[model samples]
Target: MPSQSAVGSIETKGFPGVLAAADAMVKAGRVTLVGYIRVGSARFNVNIRGSVSEVKTAMAAGIAAVEKTEGATLESWVIIPRPHENVDTILPIHYTPESEIYRQRVEGGGAPLQSLPGNS
Candidate 1:
């Protein structure tokens, strides 16, 4: 399988903060809002995929949004450019049906990896 593109993630303390971060990320850059993982302890991680620069832009926006939200704590954030295909399959960072449109818009060329079916 082909390797996946860059991936960015922002972990926030609550659902609302993560929601805000997701919105900010999409609006701030040409990045796909792949999915969010809900870790235990009420934390959620918003993930996006794009070019390295775009991923960085999106992550910055996400972090800012998380910081600005009341009662929301930014636990962590990361950007992995050109991640291994194994990581794509093994981690919860792949695109979903819901994010296909955004992926298309951001990628703007070849198709992305087959989206994991169902809601993320």
Candidate 2:
């Protein structure tokens, strides 16, 4: 069966903008930062995947971040709810094993990063 997760992409005109979007996206929702795509001409895309609601939340936060970044233009964006299996297989939206850990942590409501005791 096709995955129940949604996929989203936010495009920005510059790297700094895209990076800001990515950081905000992941922080604002329980979504995974799937990957970044360089679309030539200084444009970049930040991909994310998660539940429909989560994807929507992340997209909103990401777009806002891009808007605030200097010299970063919001190019375009899309969010596909329950994308086809073929799309997941062909696109870079699927989560890797490494990213799965993050997904699980978020889903389980675990902290994004664990703090080591007495590290400071």
Candidate 2 Cα misplacement greater than 4 A, ranges: 1-3, 109-112, 115-120
| Over 4 Å off, model 1 | 1-4, 109-120
Candidate 1, pairs of clashing residues: none
Model 1, 1-73: lDDT tens digits are: 2244689989889998999999999999988888888897989988888888888988899999999999999
Candidate 1: global Cα-lDDT?
0.84
Error of 2 at 73 (Å): 0.6
Error of model 2, residue 46, in angstroms? 0.8
Best by TM-score: 2
Q: Residue pairs in steric clash, candidate 2? A: none
In candidate 1, position 118 carries an lDDT of 39
lDDT (C-alpha, whole model) for all candidates: 0.84, 0.87
